[model samples]
Target: MFSTSIRFSADCVDDHVWLGDLEAAENTFMLDKLNITHILTILDYKPVYNKDDKRIRLYIEAEDIGSYDLLSSFETCYHFIENAVQNNHNILIHCQAGISRSATIVAMYFMKKYTLTHEEAIEKLSNKRCYHMVCPNNGFQSQLQLYHQMNYAVDKTHELYKDFQSERLRTNYGLEKSDKITKTEKEIIDDTDRFPIKSEEKTLETEEVEYQCKTCQHKLFTRNDLFYHQQGRGKSDWSTKPLELDETICDKQVFTYYTDWMIDVFDSNVGDIHCISCQTKLGEYSLDGKKCECGHWVMPAFHFDQNQIERHNEMNHNHVEKS
Candidate 1:
């Protein structure tokens, strides 16, 4: 078991990068003590920090789950770390805990950038940090393997393409008419001619039917939340379907729900919302309504974290899938 008391700060992976937990990321004192110049937070919620001219922060909206399609963010995160290192800044990569999501990303970075095999990259990370804690979950491991294999295939194809071009040039110039193409080269050329290599794009399909608590297997929201905005006028009144909450079912244990008047005066909600049955954190309740990035005003009743909740498909009600 991982103990927060044992280690809650950053672990240096190299001169440029460090892996840490939420506590270290949130605490300015810790960040300053470590001389961390840049921070990369991969979490569901936005990080709250004081603006400082000396420090830079990057937030990637991510969930700390095995099946959260973290690979989709891999390229973006890798480039960010690369830029930070090139600029001679020490960067801290963190999630809620530094055990899984963040660790997986660091390992993938090494694998992709350094051309290290998955095992080699993971071993290097473990040697630098806590070996016991630097473990990616099974789903993350599988995805990492897939990423490695895909890259390997692309690299090999490029190499073969180069060889094929050289052989064709030699034959065309009559330098070696008797020279024959190797079986592998012939196959590669044929395949390349038939189907060109394209970049892989990851797509996230939203599960709009039902959202359930990860801990208790309790249904939190149904299709009722999916609706068009009644007041908006821009393109469409279709508000982003946030998990609509009934005051009776969800308990305001994490954050208390304030009335409309109180929210306007305070400029923020008082507390987070939680599941009444298990007291699991569901989300926050914004009484005055929060503006989304897509230019729509949504009443933040319960913003469910895709990592913390399991989504149930509308077509298959019995099967539960991870978001």
Candidate 2:
């Protein structure tokens, strides 16, 4: 059975851009409801969709794995989205979960078109798409940083350009370098030169915050049961460790079910957690009290997944309302 947690609603990021998961993108009824005129699919393999003459479709074959070169498709996908939006056509971009691959593309689009930094673009997208989570993987994050440096750096002369020059030098000197400098290596060089290398240490900084169900505004987890936690030490950290749900948190607040993907991946009977009242997916919970790599035996709470719930902040709520 498909878990309700796997089901997601399309979120409008702007007047012309909508972000959603594969399920929402494939849902004909949802697409019609959103009046999406164009669809952009990013995946490792070819996407199979019902042929719809009325809706334009663009498929980008790229793996969601960190090693995949997503940068190659950035320019093409950006222009495709730009052209569609320029013509007043609403576009929906999707990947498997709309959390990584598709989110990275949309964030890059925002950076290129709006001249926003990586952080700014992510925040903007998150605020607009109040439901869906927008967490790009580490590889994508580094690439985006490089993209920002190349496109938005105040100093025209940066190490990225210097690295390109060095690569040319190595090639000219007949030095044995790889036939092609992979995108991942380039990003590493860019990062090493531009910023301090990050450490592997995981630190949990918790903030007591009230969270409410995104669908019905029902109070679910409060400061006692909910706390925002980041894994890494730096501002450029991409680790979005789930919110820690106290074991004492009311079990009645959520219902549990499992998806095939979860069962296959976790290799155990794991259930997707969702709000009991609105049936909105909160996150995945471990019935066996599994311990994460961080050595914390906290339940896996995906309250950070914007689709499930949001931190109860009056200012943020007002800002969302006004926007």
lDDT of each: 0.58, 0.59
State candidate 2's TM-score. 0.47
Per-model RMSD to reference: 23.9, 24.8
TM-score of each: 0.46, 0.47
Pairs in clash, predicted candidate 2: 43-62, 131-306, 131-307
lDDT string, candidate 1, 135-241, tens digits: 88876776677668668332323434334333333333222221343565345434432111121321123433455677897776543332223222344334545
Off by over 4 Å in 2: 1-8, 152-323
Q: What is the lDDT of residue 117 in candidate 2?
A: 88
Please tell me which predicted candidate would have the highest TM-score against the true structure: 2
